[model samples]
Target: MRQTELSITVPATANLGAGLPGATLSRRLGMVTVRDSRPINPNTWTVTVTSTPFITGAGSATQTIPTSRVSYWSGPAVRHTGGGNLAPGQPTSAQAQTLTVPRIAFRKTSGNANNRVSWEPTLVIAIPSGAVTGLYRGTVTHSVS
Candidate 1:
């Protein structure tokens, strides 16, 4: 049997949100789905995530979201029952997974459309009391192998 690589799907960009100084804010990064398309008995894979510090004002002002403040959970799952048959439902409540820079987002044990998995990651950040209120931007990159 031949093993195949894992594939991950995510939005090109997402808004973590905006808020007043000293205010805590949160935003869902939307559904991130992954699949191991390998045609072997046990195709295992892992995913990792990292991000750049949020920056604004000519890239001088900056802030970083602590990895502890980011978390993810399995979202609704779509399953392929059989020949063109599909089913969708919410799975067991998976505990929130804290994110660390270059940390593993998730792992897959096998490959199959029926075994596809997805997650919704949330970023929670607190604006410093002295934060110069303005628009800040950052990037969250995910890698799979």
Candidate 2:
């Protein structure tokens, strides 16, 4: 009887010139109700942000919700995969840092090559007191770089 041994190896390759990081809201905040005398409970919405790097560097991300008039919807807060809950300080503005990675990567690397490159964003909406009874509307914009 004869025995043979074989060796196999895989090379690490990174495709650096394909897709850009992107994000989108799962669904609109659609038809929230606010009363005249009571402060509304914090409403949380989910945002899906893809972690594909921008071909050159780790693609960063940010989110901003403009100040709303009716119902006084304000106090926007953001929580990313990282370990901190942060406030944007004002409406209609993005945070100063790159969005945190939702999980630790396989090789201590960032971007889509690491692992599942999707992030869930938690958004909070605050409706103030004494808001006029009417249909209110606003927009939240997200970006990845």
Candidate 3:
């Protein structure tokens, strides 16, 4: 088995809230390092996450309905590819992605050069009615292929 170890690192992380349906808030995840097999070329991937409470806003604070929703735009992903943005490319194969909340069966799509890159878990933390606010936090469990 050919072993070529590479490192993955994400700079900015994003966690957003859709007040209505158009508004968006981009939060940075972080860097990552995987000690596993690396892919020879870039591949296609899809990222999916479980519905969980992420960031905190207010305690039982009823606010307006958000506009935009949470999204992961690979482009302008905080990396210098020498060419341009390498967005929506491959996060599932990222090296590192900082997480705060606790989730289950959550998956995201990313790229992999050495499987040691950090990733940004763009979680969509929704604020529901009668929800116990005040820094409602948890964790998100990730899985890659």
Candidate 4:
């Protein structure tokens, strides 16, 4: 039997550009690919995502954008293959979820071997009026299981 496996790929970096205080910035995080190669009859997999606070200075409250201020939307899949029901966790902006906790980004159900799903997720950041001015950096993590 083939080796059962599940994996995910995410962009190394996503630059949402500059935004003024109290402004909302949104940008696409590039392509996220999930591959499932399980030979089981009823294979299933899920992709979860999370993020850290974005800090520009010493990570103080004034210089930090909490994970709760970061929102994610796993828009529709750009490409996919094999037979499976692939669904996006947040298909629209109204359904976007905060990054305060691990949220399902994508899921595949009733799929077999050699299946793949790809999508471009968007990130929206809400800059607080009291936020400091500088380049804020944060990490967004994606996992599959």
* Clashing pairs counted in every model: 0, 0, 60, 0
Candidate achieving the largest lDDT: 4
Tens-digit per-residue lDDT, 51-117, candidate 4: 9999997888889999999999999989998887888999988999999999999988675768889
- Model 3: CA > 4 A from native: 1-26, 32-48, 51-76, 80-121
State each model's CA lDDT, in order. Answer: 0.58, 0.23, 0.34, 0.91
Best by TM-score: 4
Query: Residue 15's C-alpha lDDT in candidate 1?
Result: 82
Rank the models by lDDT, top first.
Answer: 4, 1, 3, 2
lDDT of 1 by residue, 14-118 (tens): 887678777867677777776666555555566677766566676544444444555444334433221221222212224545455465566654434434666
Give all candidate RMSDs, comma-separated. 5.4, 21.2, 9.1, 1.3
For candidate 3, the per-residue lDDT at 35 reads: 33
Model 2 lDDT vs. the true structure? 0.23
Q: How does residue 121 of candidate 4 score in lDDT?
A: 94
List the lowest-lDDT window of 10 residues for candidate 1. Answer: 81-90
Per-model TM-score versus the true fold? 0.68, 0.25, 0.36, 0.95
Per-residue error for 94 in candidate 4, Å, reads: 1.3
Ranking by TM-score: 4, 1, 3, 2
How does candidate 1 fare on TM-score? 0.68
For model 4, state the Cα shift of residue 111 in Å.
Answer: 2.4
Superior candidate under TM-score, 1 versus 2? 1
